[model samples]
Target: MGVEVLTVSSKGQIVLPVKMRRTIGITDGDKLAAFASDDGVIMLKVVKVPTVQDFKVRLDEAKDWAESVGYKEEDISDIIKSVRLAKRENSN
Candidate 1:
């Protein structure tokens, strides 16, 4: 909760304070996302990477929605091709 100092090892690893870890519910082996802000501040957040099954379920739902909207498989394929071509032209 208060200001705490930590030392980085030669391997560039720092142990978070026990109190801070406990308060934030951070456990050992948890994944953390680290990014630098525009102001040069580095921040870390606990994040989860979705599994393959998760993506499969999402794709199924999207397909169901598209079918409900009366879009056929060929229609979807053509739309995808058109969008890809447009994106390529814009990049050029």
Candidate 2:
């Protein structure tokens, strides 16, 4: 683990140290997901936003796997309905 003390600017922006950025390959304009814990600790993670093509590729793979497992279209639809009903019941 590496630790570096950083000072927040007037606009509440803190420059990530060059060493840390180089280590993590964080370039300028990269999207970062920030989270704050109950203990006042902040964590930043590099966000890899998935494109529509990515979703389509994953869905195709899932469909192929399901077909190989002998699941038909109606079977998939029934599974989805069952899951949605279970979710509604749990939420209530």
Candidate 3:
């Protein structure tokens, strides 16, 4: 577990300390999400989904719409699988 105490500054910036950031490999420009549990346990989660960049998301939706309109585009699942594998390697 992390340290049990933290300070929220007057300017509303909550600085995460060095050791916690080191454990997560977080750096500038990464996005984060904050949520609270039913029992009032507020949490900050590193967003892994956003780490998977939005490669061809709009194209995927367009493909689905095209198929619905009886205009089929060729399946590119294999290409996506390869790209996802490469991205996983790169993120690591």
Candidate 4:
């Protein structure tokens, strides 16, 4: 768990710190959910964590995990790379 302090702008917008946004992969045009806790604390959560250009990273991570769990490296790498390249093309 981590916390970041951000000053709300005059336009009533608070930019989540870059570190937080990048960590959560939230991007422009994405919707967030805001709620109030029982203790009167305002909470903001990403309603949908966007998959922007992050599929590559996820694929690499998954490959490592799967290999550790006894997956065949050749097959996993081929599939992951294909999907990653497709995502890159689609993002353009």
Alpha-carbon lDDT, every model: 0.66, 0.68, 0.57, 0.63
Q: Considering lDDT, where higher is better, how would the candidates rank from best to worst? A: 2, 1, 4, 3
Q: How do the candidates rank by TM-score, highest first?
A: 2, 1, 3, 4
Clashing pairs in model 3, backbone N/Cα/C closer than 3 A: none
Maximum-TM-score candidate: 2
List model 3 lDDT by residue over 1-92, tens digit each. Answer: 33334677999678878787777777888667553334232344456543223324534675688688765434445545676687777679
| Model 4 lDDT-worst window of ten | 35-44
Q: Which ten residues in a row have the lowest lDDT in candidate 2?
A: 35-44
Roughly what TM-score does model 2 have, to 2 decimal places? 0.45
- Predicted candidate 4 versus true structure: per-residue lDDT over 1-92, tens digit per residue: 35454677999787788788788777887677553334223343555563534444655786689889887856755766677787777679
Which candidate wins on lDDT? 2
Q: Compared with the true structure, what per-residue lDDT tens digits does model 2 show for residues 1-92?
A: 34555688999888888889888888988876553334233445446765556555656786799999999876856876777787777679
Candidate number with the higher TM-score (1 or 3): 1
How far residue 34's Cα lies from its native spot in candidate 1, in Å, is: 0.9
How many pairs of residues in model 3 come into backbone collision? 0
Better of 3 and 4 by lDDT: 4
